[model samples]
Target: MKRYGHGLVLGKFYPPHAGHHHLVRTAADRCERLTVLVCAASVESLSLEDRVAWMREVHPGVRVVGTVDDIPVDVNDPAVWDAHMAVFRAAVPGRVDAVFTSEAYGEELGRRFGAESVCVDPGRSVFPVSGTAVRKDPVGCWDFLEPPVRAALARRVVVLGAESTGTTTMAWALAEHYRRRGGVWARTRYVPEYGREFSEHKLTALRTLHPGASWEEVTFASKEFPLIARRQAQLEEEAARAGSPVVFCDTDAFATTIWHERYMGGLYPAAHEPRRQHLWLLTDHTGVGFEDDGLRDGEHLRPWMTGRFREELARTGRRTVELTGPHERRLATAVAAVDALIGEGWDLADPLPETP
Candidate 1:
C-alpha cells in the first residue's frame, strides 16, 4: 500500500459509470492527489465539456480536466503513441508519481509516464461495465450509470392536453406499464404536473384569507408561470435521474407555456423550451369528458385548448402521438409508441478505435 504524492487516471468516460468511478476512487485512495484526464474525440457524440462536468461532479475531490484528442489510437505504433502522449501530457503537465488504469495498456502507459502503472480490477470482476457496452445498449447498462448520466440519457415522454383529457391518467398508466417489464423498468417514474400543485397551494392560501374562496377565485399572476415551469423542469430532471430509461410526465414545462397563454391571454416570455423531451403524447379531448376536480374551470374551452396544443406541438416540431378513443385504446397506443421510442436505442457515436 504505497501512497503517491500525485496520481493520474485518464479515460474517455463517455458517460461516467460505476466502473469508472471505482477506478477513480481506488486511485484517489492510494494517492495524496489525483488528476483524472478525460480525453474525448471530435467525432464522438458526447461533448468533452459534458464528460468533464460529469466526472467532476462524480469525483469532486479529484482534479478533472478534458482535452480533445482526435488522433486515432494505435497502441503498438510509436508515432501514434507519441501523438497521444502529447495530448495526455499537455492536459496533465504536473502528473508523474503513478498512472492508474484498468485497461491492459496500463504497463505501457506507466512506462511512457515514467510512473508506476497500477491496474485496478483489470479483469472487470468489480463493477463489470465499459463505455463501449454502454454506448451500444444504455438500457442494459442503466444500473452502471451515475445519476447525471442517467438523466442525460433518459427519454422523457410528456403526456399533456386540455384539462381532464386523461393526461395524468395516461402518464400514470404508462409508468405502470413499463414497471411491469421488471428489471430496470421496475423503477419507471411518472412526474406530476407542478402547475396543479402550485394551483392547489394558491387556492389554499386564498381560502385562508377568504373563508369561501373557490377555485375560480384563485388566479395566476404572469410572473408565477416562470416559477411553475422551472419547478416542473426540476421535478422532471429528478425523476429522469432515478427512474428507468424512460420517464413519463403528466404535463411538462411546454404544457405550462400553453396554460400560461390560456390564462394570461399572452405568450409567456420565459416559457421553458422542452429540450430534453423526446416525445409528446397529446391526449385528445374528443372522447374524454372534463371532470371538475375543483382545480379545473375550462370545461367549455376544452376544444380551443386541445386545438391550441395541436397547433403549438406542430409549430414546435415536437414528436407527438395524439391519443384518442377509449382509455384502454389510448393506453395501448401510448404503450406502442413508447416501446418504439425505446427500441430506437441511444445513437451514441462510436469512439476512436484502439488497436488490439
Candidate 2:
C-alpha cells in the first residue's frame, strides 16, 4: 500500500464504463496526483474529445488528457512498445511515480516509465466488464455504463408529424411496449412535444388580457421557434441520459424546423440543428381525425404539414417510416420498426488489438 507522488493510468477508453471508473478511483486513492491519458486512434467511432470530456467529468480530480495513438499494439514486440512509449511520453512528459492498469502488461509499462506497476482487478472479477464487451453489446452492458455514455449510445427514436396525427399516443405506446420487456427496458421513457406546451402557455397568456382570446388570436413570432427547438432538444437529451437503451420522443428539434416552416412560411435556420435520431416515425394524417385541444388551430393545415414533413424528412435523408391506419396498426408498425432498430445493434468499431 505505497502511495505515489504521481501516478499514470492510460487507456483507449473508447467509452468509459464502471470498470474503467473503478480502476481510476483505485489509482487516485493510492496516489497524491493522478494523470489519466486517453489514447484514441483516428479510425475510432467515438471522438478523442468526447472520451476526454467523459473522463474529466467522471474523475474531476484526476488530470485527464487525450492524444491520437495510431500505432498498432503488440505488447511482446520491443519496437512496438518503444513506438507507443514515445506517444505516451509526449502526452505526459513529466515524472511518473507509478503506472496503474488492469492488464498483465503493467510490469513492462511501469518499467518503461521508470515507476512502480500497480495492477487493479487483473482477472476482471471485480467489475466483470471490458471495453470490447460494452462496444459489442451496449444494451446488454447498459448497467456498466455511465449516464453520459448511455446518452451517447441510446437509440433515439422520434415520433413526429402534423398536429394530432397520433404522435403523442404512438410515442407513449412505444415506450410502454418496450417497458413490458422488463430489465433495463423497463426504464424506457417518452419525451413530450415541447412546442405544444409552449403554444398552450402563449394562448393562456393572451387570454389573461382579453379573457376570451381563442387559439387563432395567439400569434407566434419567428424568434419563438428557436427557443422551442432548443428546449425540445434539451428534453430529449435529458430523457436519453436517464432512459433505457432507446428513447421515444413525441416530437424533436428536427420536427421544429418543419413547424417553423409551417408557421413562419419559410425555413428558420436558427430553429434547427443536426439531430442524432436513429429513426423517425412519421404518423400519417390519413384516416386520423384532428382534435383541437384548445391550443391547436391547424386542423385544416394537417395535410399540408404532413406533406411538408415528408418532403423535409426525405430531403434531409433521415431514416423514416410513415405510420398509417388505425392506432393499433400504427402502434404495431412502430413497435416492429423499433424492434428491428434495436436488433441491428450498435456498430461500434473495435479498437486496436492489444496482445498480452
Q: What is the C-alpha local distance difference test score of each model? A: 0.92, 0.92
Residue 204's lDDT in candidate 2: 84
Regions more than 4 Å wrong, model 2: 269-271
Candidate 1 — which residues are off by over 4 angstroms?
none
Residue 101 CA error for candidate 2 (Å)? Answer: 0.5
Q: After superposition, how far is residue 257 of candidate 1 from its true place, in Å?
A: 0.9
Give one digit per residue, the lDDT tens place, for model 1 in 1-356. Answer: 89999999999998789999999999999999999999999999989998999998888999999999999988889999899999999988975899999988899999999999999999889998999899999999999999899999999999999999999999999999999999999999999999989999999999999989899998889999989999999999999989999999999888888898899999886836558899999999997877999998999989999999999999989999999999999999999999999899999999988787
lDDT of 1 at 123: 83
Write model 2 residue lDDT over 1-356, tens digit each, in one string.
78999999999997899989999999999999999999999878999999999899889999999999999899889999999999999999999999999988899999999999999998889899999999998998999998888889999999999998889999999999999999999999999989989988998898899899989888888899889988888899899999999999999988888888888898786825667799999999989987978877888899999998899899999999999999989998999999899999888888877776
Report residue 72 deviation for candidate 1 (angstroms): 0.3
Candidate with best lDDT: 1
